[model samples]
Target: MSLVKNLLVSISCTTYNHEDYVTDAIESFLMQKTNFDFEILIHDDASTDGTSSIIKEFEEKYPDIIKPIYQTENQHLKGIKASGINVKRAKGKYLAVCEGDDYWTDPYKLQKQVDYMESHPECSLCVHAGYVVSASNKEIQRYSRPNKINKIYTAEEIIEFGGGLFLTNSMLYRTELDRNRPGFFEKAPVGDYPLAINLALQGTVYYMDELMSAYRVGDSGSWTVSSFSTIDNKIKHFDQISIMLNRINQYTNLQYQHVITRTKKRIQFYLLVEQEKFKEALKEEFKFIYSEFGYKDRARMFLQGYFPGILMSLITIKRKLNL
Candidate 1:
């Protein structure tokens, strides 16, 4: 057994088929200018695309800084999440994440987060704004909240934030938060959001306004891109979220019942719409996904769900008239 000692922070990085971008991630970790000792615990989940080999190359170069778990077979396919597995191996007081595709842009990112976490005992989690870079790296979507710096986010607020207040790559949280993680994390098929919420329940999480990272979107190995592009996958994902929320509600003694239930309903409504079972969606309460859709879109949803034939006829007529 390896002794985990004298580590101030552990960077939990999980990679699978990210050979194209894994080096940037590792270099980011190695470039941090911090006064404290930190370890990078990497897990290459049996990537067939030379991702594991790339990780091995880095491990050989920086054996002291990088500790890796190279799986023979895909662990993610067997319901094991890389962050969860990495957390179990992490020995530092604080844990940070930057997946294979995502990389830290600021060298002071670790130092800044650690300085704040050490100073503030009440904070269990710390997050910062990140730029969303396209796979081509030519375009970026900004995630800045200049007015909300050092804002303390509550458990309820994090849970109801609908998944985009911060990116997983931009988080630095307490390692002990792993101890309070619910069993659903092992099987729920989603991470980050639930993990953040779990930490928020123990202590309030804070946010920094600075952009310290770049989150790679539309990358080949991006889970968000792959998960929601297909109707079947989206429905399956919602079903998993439903089970996860049920377990969370049970664990919290129904404290987040209303919010979780509303979240579940929102997922279900979209699943129904994707499946063209809109009639069923119209029967349930509507929660406006203000972030993704607007009033006219909602009206169109209702029309398509309840009056499919009429809406189809209108669509055909509009196309014929070039309107």
Candidate 2:
């Protein structure tokens, strides 16, 4: 097995009980065709399933490139982020992130991003378009920025987008930025959004229109599935997100105050709706943020507020019909 002498890119991945999907994620990293050497840094947070064994298998096969960190206990439960561990261990010019459930499709994905970042010194981060796949690895929808054209987004815009603007697997950023992480990041509920804001503050963020990676949704042990599992869970998660935004506000010296304020209000409105407190959500204070919702959301809120019994009956019927 040949070892990499000078690593140019470090593929950072975090996994937990991803037995069914972890193999695809690992294989995707190994299949990458790049001129410069790259290392795969996988942090398995005490996976109870076969994920650890599968990772050990890959490490045995590609001993030089695969670096596995096996945890006896799950750090995530201890409020430690597995992603940060891989980021700290990354010793490369660029850091690429792809969680265990997500996989990249294009072999040239790393090379392309590296080439762009190499030429463009102002770009601290580079992200490309990708697909949102189901738990079964079936394509569900495209995960991408709003515009189809490749463009650079400012720090203010990154703050306004609030995280879901780009997929995590598609991210390739400068590793140096993570060395001195800001205090705000520690308080963040999720790492990606705050990290994006942190990077954008350092330099411009580049968005490429190429389709490369796939983000798996509805996967077990994933943040999305767990956060949206119940109304209480959602409220707690959203509250944490709001706190993160406040930290970002302070970190940026309130330069993006207006945007941050609006973003928090939007979250507030969302939380109210999620709690089925439609009367409060429809109040005058949250009225401004109502424009953020779609037709279905508006209709549902109206029904829940005015015709709650009817709405509950409809929900029960839908559940009875298994819809």
Candidate 3:
């Protein structure tokens, strides 16, 4: 409930056990060059590592700019999201997100997004592309872009693409859009995707083809790693996503029924593929979904489904030859 007068943007960051990377994230927020005032609202979910200490160092150095919530107990284990806490406490016209493991690269990133949002009041959210880096911060590649140029995405497109369409740290959206989020958002397993969909529902969502941040992948304690570490967890996550989409469909009053159904089918198709149910995946209904996969992936599926020995032999040879 703390309000900052004339604060243009509030950077909401959540962290847990990110000792090695928290400094980079804090430094990135401090490095932003902007004409308007911005505040950093960081929530430490009782990190077991030295992440809290690092955040404290920055908080001490920049008391006026950094407002952090240090948790004594891990709220995540109790089913409370730290991001939710940060969002409720945020006191900015616009909210930008950068997780503890991610960092912004462009000093003018906030300025650029703020300028666009200010001029274009209809825009609910603005996101840019960024570099995808390894756990050690080595640049792996640029985040995949759905469009070759800057474009505005529709709600249907956002629903169809789901969560992975945009980089999380590159997102900046109006704070009001998040204040009245639908009830389903509280239960959504993934935050960024549902938030984006909600924003798209409100107004225009613009994408700028600018590499303005670095999104770290393969972080040990990251959501992706924890959610996909086991087959059971993977299935559980898929089920959660399915439920979220169903709720979204209801929340939209079935206006986006077709899009939500298509997304659910896509997820179901992946689950079937993961379970190696080739017969089910080859059924007429699911067969069309194969077109979404690359030719190499289709080939691999065929090989795995029919010629397991051959596929294993090829994999063994590839690994032996370091291909």
* Global Cα lDDT for candidate 3: 0.79
Off by over 4 Å in 2: 283-323
Q: RMSD to native for every prediction?
A: 6.7, 6.3, 6.2
lDDT tens digits, residue span 1-323, model 1: 02335579999999988988898999999898887889999998888898888888888887787899989899878877778888988889999999988899999999999999999999999988777777666277544342344678778767755255677888998998785467766657778878887888889788898889988766654787678667777677778778888988888999999888776766666566557674564562653432233223333433332223344443443354344
Candidate lDDT values, in order: 0.75, 0.79, 0.79
| Winner of 1 and 2 under lDDT | 2
Ranking by TM-score: 3, 2, 1
Q: Model 1 — which ten-residue stretch has the worst lDDT?
A: 298-307
Q: TM-score winner between 1 and 2, please give it.
A: 2
Index of the highest-TM-score prediction: 3
lDDT for model 1: 0.75
**Better by TM-score, candidate 3 or 1:** 3
Q: Estimate, for each residue in 94-213, the C-alpha lDDT of model 3 and write its tens digit.
A: 999999988899999999999999999999999887777887755664454545589898999888773667788989999988886787788988788888899999999998988889
